[model samples]
Target: MRRVIKNDDSEVKKSNLGYIEGNSNNNLKISKILYKEQKGFCIYTEEYLGRADARDIEHFDPTLKGTSDDSYSNWFLVKHQWNKEKSSKWADYQPVLHPTASDFNERIVYDDGDYRVSELDDQEAINLIKLLKLDDIILADERKKYIQRKAKELSIYGVSPEDFFKILIDDDIKQISYLRAIHEEFKIDIWNLLPNPQ
Candidate 1:
């Protein structure tokens, strides 16, 4: 997972949702805000939030969802399947890195389609990968396919790596999926490739 920098000034952060229960309209608004904040990518899988895939509001600390502690800081947009897979499973494992608070690249490393902890003994990172099924067969296969397709495109005559990297980073063309895996495969640092680097 990539580091997610929450926009402090976002509209959702200005108000409180802790008191509301089953508020669909507010939930939709929050989802839209989070979708934009996350750059239309799922928090866990980094999958593009397109019409074909289902999505959900994932709580980083699920236990806080209905409690007085519920807030934007605990919320994230994730793939529906991942959310279901993670349901009631957090307590059983070590606390994983928080997208908003932790430097993901520092704790975890992506090698092709697999995710492993940068530090061999980091149990939390290990659990994070397992808990989210970051290296599930299906996801890995999709990532492999994407890497091969991009490699073939790169092999075409006159297709410069620089130009192609721009396309990969271009959100207007398409919201990127399996970003860390793509980075590992291409040996590119996506941050430097941003059109207007943050």
Candidate 2:
């Protein structure tokens, strides 16, 4: 997963996020914005959203800290499979990071198209992965496909694998860390900055 910059917090759609809307599709509307943020990717596992894939509206502040779950900043859009797999938890069970508070690029690692903890002993982060099953074979296979396709596509564009990766991170494209994985697995470079976990 990558760090996403949320956009629907714009004043116009503020109502859609909470109190006034009372709409059943409130989550769906939120999903649309998040899809745009993630570039049609899942927030947890970084899987590209396909037509058949369904999204889930997750509350960041499920504990209702100072506000309801529907509160504007609390929302997140994830795949249905992810949502179902990750049930509720209190502070001790919180994910390794939050979109606003954590940088996935720092906490996550990608080599050989696999997302693992940058720090091997970061048990909390590892637990989060296990809880979400982010490294499952199904997701790994999808990520592998993206690695191959993106590597070749960029090669054709005369974009060096290094430049391709820096471009994605610089642009804040969602799942950037995953894209970096593709870079690591495909790149034959004797140069280019390696993925920074700092």
RMSD for each of the candidates: 3.3, 7.4
TM-score per prediction, in order, is: 0.84, 0.63
Residue pair clashes in candidate 2: none
lDDT (tens digit, per residue) of candidate 1 on 1-198: 666777779768776544256888878888877887776778888777776778989888888878878888888889898999998788887767766656677887777677778898888788777888876888878877887887888797356766787765663535456767766777777545544212
Which ten contiguous residues of candidate 2 have the minimum total lDDT? 189-198
Q: Considering every candidate listed, which one attains the maximal TM-score? A: 1
For candidate 1, the lDDT comes to 0.75
Stretches of candidate 1 exceeding 4 Å from the true structure:
15-19, 165-175, 187-198
lDDT of 2 by residue, 1-198 (tens): 545556545432665455334465754565666666555656676555666878776665556533545565566667887777666543555445555545666776665766788888877667666666767888788778877777677788787766776666566544343534554675543113333211
TM-score between model 2 and native? 0.63
Q: Give one clash count per candidate, in the order shown.
A: 0, 0
